[model samples]
Target chain A: MKKIIIASTSAMYGGKYLEYLQPVLQEHFKDCSSLVFIPYARPGGITHEAYTAKVAETFTAIGINVKGLHEFDNPAQAVLDAEALFTGGGNTFLLVNELYNTGVMQALEKAVHAGTPYLGSSAGSNICGLTMQTTNDMPIIYPPSFKTLGVVPFNINPHYLDPVEGSTHMGETRETRIREFHVFHRQPVVGLREGSWLEVKGSAIVLGGDRHARIFRQGQEPEEVAPGADLSGLK
Target chain B: MKKIIIASTSAMYGGKYLEYLQPVLQEHFKDCSSLVFIPYARPGGITHEAYTAKVAETFTAIGINVKGLHEFDNPAQAVLDAEALFTGGGNTFLLVNELYNTGVMQALEKAVHAGTPYLGSSAGSNICGLTMQTTNDMPIIYPPSFKTLGVVPFNINPHYLDPVEGSTHMGETRETRIREFHVFHRQPVVGLREGSWLEVKGSAIVLGGDRHARIFRQGQEPEEVAPGADLSGLK
Candidate 1:
């Protein structure tokens, strides 16, 4: 059975790194002593070593060891052999580009399907969907394809924000962007707000956290879904 | 020689479409009667005809006739023979995709280089830069390539927003996103705030409108450029 925890963000407002999800992660990786971290996203352009060390510090508190995927000579083998996997947040374009370039996208998908515990946040969680077309990140780099792991049937708009009331910004709101996405794609999208996640075990997928997620379907009005609701039937 | 008006947005907060740039555009297109409108970006997923109609209504107020590129038999030819050109705001990915798909990307670039009075807003303004990598729009679609019209030497981050004071949103700020882009790209980026624009005439590119623009260069701190400042030196 596959076990995955896809979160909208790694941290919350004024919260320490991964502090909000400490309890959930402890339970998710309880059986694993060490996990492989994919730090290719390199948030804020931080180096691979620096990003890995940050993750290591977070996992140390949970009694789990951490190893960056970049440290391995063969990243695919590292992912397949790891007891658990965690991909942190950053630019989705950079994350997908690195995943495909390193030839570990398939291996990670296979490892997760074979039941290795997996955790993803933000850009990491966005790749667990059908395609990265609905991401809110800038296209800092071009990837070979928009196709992703597709571990989840629908797409995810991580760190999804609501329209500000009486705002003067002319930029498209999150809902308007997702609605435009439906014009080109039929894949369902979940507007995953911060502090929320989707817990997938085997064929079951449930929304986790304290807030509600907005669900968008093609050619239909968006619907709000509360936490703990089964989202496995999204497709 | 290139005569271009690259604006952060077509409309201001609580303003009508293209209302903010009415006077600038009136002067920019004073010599021409009919102008070609590229409605490929299609804000809110509106039809090309509908989007063009909205722009037409605005241009009509300035004594200029409007025609959508989609109405032509050969889009590329229409661009080459256009008296004036305007690409309205919307999804950058979709706009770039259509520009390349219909073979108008090169044609429009050539026309602009030949001194066609051209106006662009938001995504439209983004392409006037070296690439569309700095746009804040969602990746609702994937273009064949990120390369765009290089009429300007630097990339433009349209609708540039400053970090909100004391906000707890976990999402990366506009400055952080642009800084990350610098890791892989050396091109300078101009964070064009709403109501601001870049006026390019021949070899001189000057910042226009009421506000200041943020300029980001690799390995250096961002500098704020005031209105009417010459930006042609950015490279």
Candidate 2:
């Protein structure tokens, strides 16, 4: 019975970090007294301790204690032993690099599949997909592979954006980029817009939050999925 | 002398492909009767022959014949024997993949460095830098490496855009993305706007076109280099 919350972002427009998701998180993480946080993503190049403390300040408000995985001697064991787990957003390349280098990727995947309550935002949520091929982040560093935890059936395009009308920029749009991904990859990609999230319980995956997500399947027209839509069929 | 034109894009806001730069190109390739074009990037997933023909259409107007490297039996030899060269824009990952897979990366770099008049746009221009770390394109495919030609001293962010004034998007801005790149790499990055280009004549790299280019150096404030500004000091 896998339970997970894969969010598009940690913060939304003019909102405090994780503020909008706290109610859902409080209910989702009700069974756990403390959670092991994976701060390897290091948004803005912040230190592990600092990022963890930032997360701790939020979780503490919900009567849940938080500890960073880096605080532990063995990160693999930390994931295996965590009552609940949460990974914050940052550079996906950096996150994947550390996950592979520290040999914690397998442990984290196994623990989550074995029914640990897991919450991931942005880069954290991206690792739940088939691959990081759809990520919108820069390639500041290369990981051993673009392979990620296959907790979900398809790849996720977190912070998915729509093309601006009448833009003069010649760069590929978010939609165009995804189309290019399909030229080489067959995996379906879920363009999860900000304020949107996927709630997973066993084989059931539902779209939550205020907006709609765009589903892109190979050789098929992209379709808009409204909030509360069941996406388990995609798997 | 290494004579090259690394442009942000092949076309401007409302212009045809290579239209605005025709005069400059005519002068740049004055003595060359024909050019070897690398269509490895394949903008919009176009075929090699089709993309080459498109370039041929543009060059034919300038009284220069165009031949795609793909048409040659040996791409490396074609590059070495060519009087001039051009690489078009598309997905950088795809271009880099073909460059490494076909063993043309080294040959192309060698030819360009050995005084060949070369032209690059978008993804092609990005390869002229130290690495493809600053490219605005999505990672549609994995390349053997991010290492590029280093024809120029630093990295380039082609089709560079500014932060929208009142946007609610949560994705990192172009400037923020470049700043993030500086966290892991010390190489300076030039945010080349769509209409801007770098005119490389020997060691003198001058910013060209109407707009100012944004320069990002690690641990230093970003600076705006006006059009026609000599960037030889950077090298």
Candidate 3:
């Protein structure tokens, strides 16, 4: 059984981000002895060494014994040594490129299916989906293809929101974007809002977050998903 | 010489939306003789009768001959007759899905290449790309595929924006999303800020708006594009 814990933050060590999320991460990986952190998305320049280092320090203080995988450029070896893999979020494109280039994404998929604990945050959480179709970023550079790491069956929309009032931006609203997503992707999107998370343990799915996720199937009005709801219904 | 004018709104007559985009529409298509509105996206949700009289009234009041082409269910004829086609903004998924399902996307593509003067707004602009890879919507639903009416060589990030100061929203910022778009799409994205537009006349690409549209390319810093600037440099 693959125990996947997709969070929204890196470790705090002595800091706090989404303070509500810390307990959930700790409780989810209580049994794991060590957690491996992969921080490769800094390439797009959204992430910095200071934040990554802080993540390392935070995990170590919590006794998670976290190590940065950038040290082991070898893709196969990184997977072989990791007990529980934790991927911190940065830019999904940067992370996806590194994983595809290094073959670490395929390796992690193998390890996850083989019952190794896998942890992911924002960009990390996005890679868990069938495609990175729900990412809210622009394509600044070019790669071989637009496909993403297909670690999960559904699409993941991080920081999903309903439209806010008095907005004059010419782009479609958040709801409209989701509706468009429903029209493009054959799969359902797990609209994971900030401060919320989804945990999968031994085939059991649990939703954890402040706001319930919004799931939209084709041709249906979007429905609200509360915490502790089962995602199998979405599947 | 295809003259495609992608506007910011359509005549959503009977709804409170027509007044919202009237001035912009008037200024853009003031001299255009004819216009064809597409409701193919609504499928069964909207009937032909429901959209025609309403859209016709508002557009005709502006002195432009408006024709809602629900009668020509045939995609080929629809593309052949419409000299100036203006695809309105709606759910892009539904729009692209119907276009693909009825095989109208290619028909539209043919007309565009033949210089039929295609004018698209939101969803309309999206269809002009290699693929709708840079859209800022959820990926919940899937169509026949992720294919679009490849009019423009690149993708369009509709309703694009700069990051708001002290905004609590968490996700990739506008700048980052465009950068991620670069990773997969080597073709530069014409980040059309809301109320912003690009008019292609003969070979002159004119940026029309009060903002700078960024051109995202791989291995390079994105360049800010201004109105009346020669876009040949982008190509």
Candidate 4:
């Protein structure tokens, strides 16, 4: 069975990195000894080694060993051999570019489909959707294609934010951007706010965390799905 | 003489559509009786005719007639024949896709380079840069290329905003996104705030409006250029 945790963000308000998700992660990785970390996203232009170490600092506390995919001679083979997998957040464009160029996107999809435990946050979580069309990241780089692993039926709009009342900023709101996405795309979009995550097991995808997630289907009104709600219905 | 007005937004805070810009636009389009308006961006999923009418209302007030490119059978030919041009803000990807698909990107570039008076706001202004890589719009559709008109020496990050103090939003700040862009591309970027604009005349590009603009250059600290400052030196 496929087991995965797709989070909107790695940290919550007033919290250290992954601190709020520690309890859930502890149980999530209980069966794994070590997992391969894909640090290709490199948030804030961080190097591969530095990003990997940052992730290791947190995973080590949960009694899990972390190995970066870059350490291996063959990244695709490493994904196939990993007992579990974790992909951190960063620029989605850069992440997708590296995944496609390194040929790890296909291999990683196969590993996850084969029931390897997986964890993803931000740009990492976005790849679980139909496409990267709804990502908030700038186009720092262009990927071979916007295609991603459709592990879930819908696209994940991570770090989803609500419109600020009386704000002077005129940029498109997160909701407006998602609505525009529906103009050209037919897939359903889940607005995953901070502190929220999707727990996928087998064919069941449940909403985790305390807040409700916003669900948007093409040509339909957006609705809020409560915490612990089964999102597999969206499929 | 390469006359152009690149605005951060079509509408400013508490102001009517193109209100603050009318004074400058009146002079910008003084010589032309009518101009071609590109509504390919289609903000908020508005139809081309509807968006064009929106621009037409504002231009008409300034004694300049507006004509949407879509009304013409040949968009490329219309661009070449335009006395002046105005491209409204909307989804950048959609606008870029339409421009490329219709083969008007080249024609528009040619027209602009030949000194046809041009005005662009938001996504429209974004394309006046070297590429649309710095755009803030969602990737609703894939464009044939991120490349755009190099009318200006660098890229423009329209609707640029600063990080809110004490805010907990985990999304990358506007500044952070531009810095990440420098990691792969070596081009200067100007963060134009709402109400601010760039006045490009011949070889000089001057900052206008009431606020300062942020400048990001590769391998250097970001600097703020005051309003009315001539930015031709950076070029």
Candidate 4 docking class? high
lDDT to native, each model: 0.94, 0.92, 0.67, 0.93
Residue-by-residue lDDT tens digits, candidate 3, A168-228 = 5645666666566555456787777777788887667778866788886767888898988
Q: How displaced is residue B41 in candidate 2, in Å?
A: 1.5
Ordering by lDDT: 1, 4, 2, 3
Please give, for residues A1-235, the per-residue lDDT of candidate 4 as tens digits. Answer: 8999999999988888899999989888899989899999888899999999989999998889999999999999999999999999999999999999999999989999999999999999999998988999999887889999889988999999999878999888999999989988899999999999999999999999999999999999999999999988895
Clash pairs for candidate 4: none
Give model 2's DockQ, 2 decimals. Answer: 0.75
Q: Output the better candidate (1/3) by TM-score.
A: 1
Select the stronger candidate by lDDT from 2 and 3. 2
lDDT of 3 by residue, B1-235 (tens): 7676654344222435455556756765666777777765442235546655666777787887877766676756776777567676665656776777777777888887788766776767777777776765443334565667766666676666778777766565777766755655577777777666767666666776566777777668878877656564564
Pitting candidate 3 against candidate 4, the one with the higher DockQ is 4
Off by over 4 Å in 3: A8-23, A31-58, A61-81, A90-110, A127-156, A179-190, A209-235, B8-34, B39-57, B62-74, B91-107, B129-131, B140-155, B183-188, B209-233
Error of 4 at B7 (Å): 0.4
DockQ of all candidates, in order? 0.87, 0.75, 0.28, 0.82
Candidate 2 residue lDDT tens string, A1-235:
9999999999989999999899999989999999999999888788999999999999999999999999899999989999999999988888999999999999999999999999999999999999988888888998889999989999999999998899887788898888888888888999999999999999999999989999999878999999999999994
Model 4 residue runs over 4 Å out of place are: none
Best by DockQ: 1
